[model samples]
Target: MTKDEFIQELEVLIRARYGVILINTLEEERALDLLTDLARKLNKRLLTWSCTRGLVMDGNTAVHPDTVDLMTAIAKAEQLAEEPSLFVWLDLQSHLNSSPVYIRRFKELAQEIRERMPSNSIIVGPLMEIPTELQKEVTIIDMPYPDLNELKMIISQFAQQYRDRNDLQIDCSESALDALGRASIGLSKTEIENCLAKSLVQHKRITGEDIDFILEEKKQNIRKSGILEYVDTEKLETADIGGLDNLKKWLEIRKKAYTPEAEQFGIGWPKGVLLVGVPGCGKSLSAKCVAASWKMPLLRLDLGRVFGMYVGSSEANIRLALSMSEAVSPSILWIDEIEKALSGLASSNQSDGGTTSRVFGTILTWMQEKKSPVFVFATANNIGSLPPELLRKGRFDEIFFVDLPNEQERAEIFRIHIKRIGRNPENFDIAKMVKLSGEASLGDGVRLTGSEIEACVNQALLEAFFVRNSEGHPEGDVTSADIERAIVQSVPLSRVRKEDIGYMRTWATDNAVRASLAPESALSSAPESPAMAEVTVGRNIDF
Candidate 1:
């Protein structure tokens, strides 16, 4: 929640004489500043306690220099018979949970405040450890990260600080400033301020270029969280990915759904898609592409690390991971090979005593009820292992079944990989390599996946780097013959796993959407194998 909204609610609760208020936050100074203003507006005495400071009134007047322990502080607070007062207890979570005597004293203090007293007890610390008996008496407030409006305020205040300095120049468009605020979403307010200040000291200028510096700050912040991984920035546009033309169209429309115009048109975010099909068909690559194309932070949720060694730790880890994802909104959470994470669901009750089931349930509920703009980009190769509940309606926007690339897509893939290495595609016979990649050209019945096709170009580069001419120098440039040798020697996974691909095609026919458009001419001339599977996609075009 915004600071204004939080202060408003706190004021209302204080006037109504609530007993105990628990604030779960890391921003102690920010919370205290708001509370100080609230106490002034209500004309109530504000008291604060710490182990070293004992009991202090309104800033620093000591109630008792001897009252420093937890029990003594409670007793001292109880003695202060002031009407309409507030006691903010700092650094108490670690001390109170140990002793039953301390717990009983807190319960009595809460009761005294509710029954006859006119004051309230406020506990500010990490995720609350309130005693089970005091659950109903305490109310929790989890402070939310700053929103875009608050971020803009911070940016304005930052720019104001350097208004007198002629050396500092600020250049930012309205849209770029908005983007900068969104990029700085998950960082603490202090981190954001420090980043903006550091940019001025380094370059004496603020522009759209400051975004990279802010993003670098975010990388450090995410690393400290220890739950979500901040994926390295590898930017890829739609043009970089080859063949998934139908998927590309769908993504292009989804990108527009996040704009302000779409909000005005009453359109919510399009739920993310689940890419399930053949291995190495660019499913994981699509996740990275979306993060780069949309300019959103990419976080990978590794399931292996989430399942902790302790009994209840796995469930807690999943919740923490999901919470962190929401904190970084308008971001992509890439869960690669998701089915493997849930593969033990059926036997969860028997093996780990429902730990796996509980973890899976947490994710299922989060996806359905989450209001955050965290797009879950999940990919999998084993569709059979996935539970039917995950494939149900409204769980994901859609499930696209990726298949092996056709002849034309192979040519496109070859062109992309070759050009990426600074080699001219025109200099090589790409048509021959495309034909050789499929079963139509060779009797081996192998259709290389996107990764396998890239491997062919890499293999050619390695061979050319080693071959020496008569002058004892490296050949330095790859040839069409070099790539041809790599293709002839490599065996694609499609050839070895024919039955698995056929089974996946059968499953897709009943339950999933097609990722690529299949041309009828190509399907007709294909051999009697998984390559000839008759797939019918949406009628964006007629065959």
Candidate 2:
């Protein structure tokens, strides 16, 4: 939802006679504009109160300018001098911890508004919490981040207003404006404006080149909190993902889910996915792929850093991190190795007085209840250490088991690594190396994972670096034999922990969706088995 939609929703709440409302937002000017429009629509007066400015009536003038105290402002409103008015309180949440009587007074004011008055009290702040005393009396909602169209308008207006500036140039083409708008997706109104200003001041032009500058701005904001890292996925794309076609097909459908047309069609936002699989598979890479494929900002959330030494500080840090994430919505939040962060949940109370448990609970609650378009891409080595509450149906949209790369996926991985090293796969017999790495060429059913395949490619290059041609000159080109030797000498995770892999595979057979697609040979005919059916959900998106 955008600013206009928020105003319409607020109008409904006011018309229904809701007494007290709490809006958690940092856009004070935007909120004031929304409230002003709401008041005009409802035919009510707009009274804004601040800690320093006291209480002001519909206009800027105040009858009693000394009504700066929160209690004094509430007392004046209780007298109902303005029968139908919106009493907006600013910086009120900061004092909720200083005194308890203030909570009681707010509760009574809510009751009085419902029973004896026609006005409503609005408490606005960057961060807010219900005092538990007025939990039922207060209705809380978040002001959503600006959508694409709103951002486009912000850019258009700025460009027109500053077109005559001699120092800075602007690109007002429709395509360029649309690109700028999409680039500013997760930023606030102020941040978007700041990005354009910075681009002009630093580069002398607001063009496509400012994308990097704008992203740098986002990274600076994320770094201030020290929990989430804004990832740069410029080099990563869906094609870089070797396999997980099952997961790929699922993700491809939701690539455009955040568009306005999708919302108009009543399409629900995708919650998230849990990837539990082999250590060397593409679980982590898939997170980067999804963010790149969706054209959304990627944030790496380090859950371990959320803990603090002070009491309740850990919980507060997690909340702060999540709040920042929501502020940058229509983005992807990647939590790699989630099991390590949540491994202590079972014994959290005995160890640290439930700090981990509380932190975990806060995350789960937000994952389930968040209305923003933050798609969580969490990867775990195994699910044994994860709390059962996290595995419940509502926590994630789907749980995918990313197994070792199959023959086709292994071949793709090899080709990708070879090209990275400036070598041609065709020169190295990738097909033969792919067969040698899998069970096709080996009697034992051994297979290299995506990471192991890349490793084999690197080791082959290392071996080839020392070999000399007939004239004693170095033959730096890798051969198929070098890769085969590396494959034979390597001990993969599948072979090292055979029993553990068996257990995980069995669990996934029943509980999780298979990530890799069936081999091309198997799909030539019909799916003969149920496992193949699950692995090949639908045709992969080739385009």
What is each predicted model's overall lDDT from 0 to 1? 0.82, 0.80
Residue 177 local lDDT, model 1: 69
User: Model 1: per-residue lDDT, tens digit, 1-543?
Assistant: 676787778888787788889887777866777788888998888899888998889977998888788788888788783567899989887777788888888889988887888899998766755678778889887766777877877777777777677888875557756867888886667878888888898999766678888988877866776777988756577787788887887887888888889999998876688999889989988888888888788899998888988878888788878888887778888899999989999999999999999999899898888888888888999999999888887779888888888776788999999999898999999988987888765544458999999999999888877785544666457899999999999988998898888788788887787888766676677543554444443234222
Q: Which stretches of candidate 1 lie over 4 Å from their true place?
A: 1-3, 170-179, 206-208, 441-445, 469-476, 524-530, 534-543
At residue 174, what lDDT does model 2 achieve? 81
Candidate 2 whole-model C-alpha lDDT, 0 to 1? 0.80
Best by lDDT: 1
Give the clash total for candidate 1: 0
Q: What's the distance in Å from true for residue 267, model 1?
A: 0.5
lDDT score of model 1? 0.82
Candidate 2 structure quality by residue, lDDT tens digits, 1-543: 666777777788887778888887888877787788788978888988888888888759784876888788788878863489888988887766679977877778888887778888888776565677878888877787677788888888888877788877878888888888877776777888888888877888877667877677778889987999988787888888887878898888877687889999999888999999888888888898788878788889999899999987898889888877877777888989999999888899999999999999999999999988889899988768878888889989888888767667877888888888997888878777876776555434346788988898888887777665544756356778888899888877676776676667777876788787776775566323333333343223343
